[model samples]
Structure formats: structure tokens, C-alpha cells
Target: MIDFKVLSDYAATFTHSENDLLRQMEEKAAEIYIPIMQPSAMAFLQQLIRWRSARKILELGTAIGYSSIRMALAAGNDTTIVSVERDEAMIEEATQNIEALNLQERIQIVAGDATDDLSEVASAAPYDLILIDAAKVQYEHLFEKCSGLLADQGIIVTDNVFFHGLVCDIDAVQKKQLHRLVKKVDAFNHFLSEREDFDTIFLTVGDGMAVSTKRSCAEGER
Candidate 1:
């Protein structure tokens, strides 16, 4: 069996080292124990943006704006990113980080519950790409909401679907609350797998990422 840790470490060696500002944000995120996309997964996301030429992007979580900034950079100057965050502290920090890079015009931070009415988000409909990395329990809800706003052939990328490997062994999760959360994550994965409208592929990169794209009518018929 392949050692995932070793594989991840090896993959890290191939990824570009983050620039100084991103490095500082990463350090701060680590020191404060904030959840951000793993470097390998982040690199994969950037690659997707470049390959797809995704100009309009939507992110469910704006944790310090790390991933948003990364996506903006990868998508080039033509990209516009709308990132939503409920936490005031996270929004403030993310705004500062985005401004530090003078990316205010490129990235917009929306403040509110992502699972709630996303009328503002819908206004920018038909996004070229959508990224979900918010609450684990609300993954399904978020997915359902974001699907409506995705472009015809656009992709939806979800992070932390594995929930630190806990979803792989729900019974082994000692804490009751954590076990419940793990079960929810596991259910969401199954839900994604069973969806008929989209073709979802699971990758074991960075906890786990589920990349889903809308299926064409002929593909759906198959």
C-alpha cells in the first residue's frame, strides 16, 4: 500500500514554494490553527484554473483569503473571485491580506452565512468554477446551492471531504460529536457519488478533494 504521508511529502517537493506574502499568511494560519487548503491540493486547484481558464470563481470559505488569492493569481488578471465568510475575524483578516496584495478589485469578500440565501452570489451566476471549503456539516447544503450558479461545463471542487481521514473510519472516531460530523462527511461523499447531474471524481490529495462537473445530456443518458 502507498503511504499517503510519504506521497504527500514527495508531492510537496514538486510544488512551487509560496511567495513571501503567502508564506506569511501560511505561517499565521499555522500559528492560529486555522484550516486552509493543503499546499498540494492548492496547487492542483491552480492547475485546474489554468487548464479551464476559469475567469469567474466562487469560494464558499474565505479563511484569511489564502485560497482566493492563490486562485486569483493562477487565473491571471482576467479572473474575478467572490469569497464568502461568516466569521468576522476571518473576513477582516482576509480583507487585509487581499488588500496587502492590492487585489481588492479582483476578489470580493461577501459576509454572511453561505448556506443561507445567496442572492448576492446568484447575481454573479454561471461561475466558471466553484470551490467549497466551509463547514463540514453543511457540505451537502452548500453543494446544492452552488450547483445552480455553476456554468454549463464548469467544475465544482470541494475540500476536506475526508475530514482528516476520520470519514474512512467513522466508528473509530472516539468523540461523539466528531463521530457525528464524520458520518455527515461520509454521507456527503456518498451523495456526491450518487448525483446524476454531475460526474464526480474523488482524489486523495490533501485530506480529500471531490471534483465534479455537470454532465451533458448524452452523458447523462449513458
Candidate 2:
């Protein structure tokens, strides 16, 4: 396998730099030991939002609001994003960041468990895009809950499915403490791949990402 980190860094060199606010937010996340979206994954997400002309977005994680900000910026001024974060501290930080960027109207942060908060998210349903970057173990449950909330033509993008490349390496799993997590992620990957209602592709980008588009009912029936 190629060194994806090296290639991802090289690819980022050609892309434009994030604004000073986002740059500072990224620094803050790093200083706090909070993980944010990788550059390659962030770029992919931005492109997806722009290509889909996403108007309503739902994000499962707001980790310092880095990815949410990127998505909002990419989708333009009219788009609205409802992001969820379980941690109150992260919510506070993310809210501050979003407000500082003058995007309070465009992005709303919900503070609660994804399972519980998703019910609130459903009120804004038929979202053009749903981003899942929350707990690795709850991915399948999150997908199930959010799938019904998606627009017929909408797309779902999940991050960190690879879980640091542990999903694909059985030997590493047996030797490490990530057996349960690796198992769950692997199962989630398989579940997504086999879903009849959606067409899914797993990519080798940042920690691996899975992009799934809901198939038409007729197409799914076949």
C-alpha cells in the first residue's frame, strides 16, 4: 500500500490555504489533542458539497467545527448545516469558532449524543448531504437513523472508516487493543457495501472514507 499521508500532503500543496480563522482553529484543535478532518478528506468533502449543490447539510460530529466550517464555506452562503457534538467542551469551542467566522446563521451546533440528537436533526429532513464523523462504534446505528432523513438524491459521506488502517489488517488487530473497534468498523463497512438501498464506494483517502448514494426505489428493487 502507498503512504497515503505522504501523498495526501503532496496533494494539499496544490490546494489553496484555509483562511486565517480556520488555520487558527486547526492549530487550536491540534493543541488540544482534538482530531480534525485531514486535508485530503476535507477537500473531498468540499468538492462533494459543491458538486451536489447541497443546501441542507447534517454533520454527526463538530470537533472544533473544522469540517463543518469547511463544508459551509464550500457550499456557499445560502447553505445551512446542523452539526452534532456530544462533548460540551467541543460544542463550546465549535460554537465560538462558527460565530467568530460570522456563520451563526448558516451553521447550528446541537449538543447531545448522536443517537438522541439525530431525532432533532430529522425535523430538518431531506438534507442534501449528511456527514458522519462521530463515534466509530455507532456508525451503523447513525447511518440507519439518518438514512431515512436524507433526500432521495442525497449523499452520505463517512470519515475514519479505516480507523487508522486497522480495518484492513487482521494481524495488527490481533496484536493490538483495537480488536472490538476494528471489528465493528469492518462490519459497518461490510454492512454499507451490502445495503440494497444505497450504492457505496469506500475510498482510501484520510483514514478511509465511504460515500454512499441512495438508489432509486426501482433501482433498488432490481
Top candidate, metric lDDT:
1
Question: In order, what lDDT does every prediction score?
Answer: 0.90, 0.86
Tell me model 1's lDDT, rounded to 2 decimals. Answer: 0.90
Stretch of 10 with least lDDT, candidate 1: 9-18
On TM-score, the candidate that comes out on top is 1
For candidate 1, the per-residue lDDT at 214 reads 85
- Cα distance off (Å), candidate 2, residue 17: 3.7
lDDT of 1 by residue, 98-142 (tens): 999989999999999999876778898889999999999999999
How does each model score on TM-score?
A: 0.95, 0.93
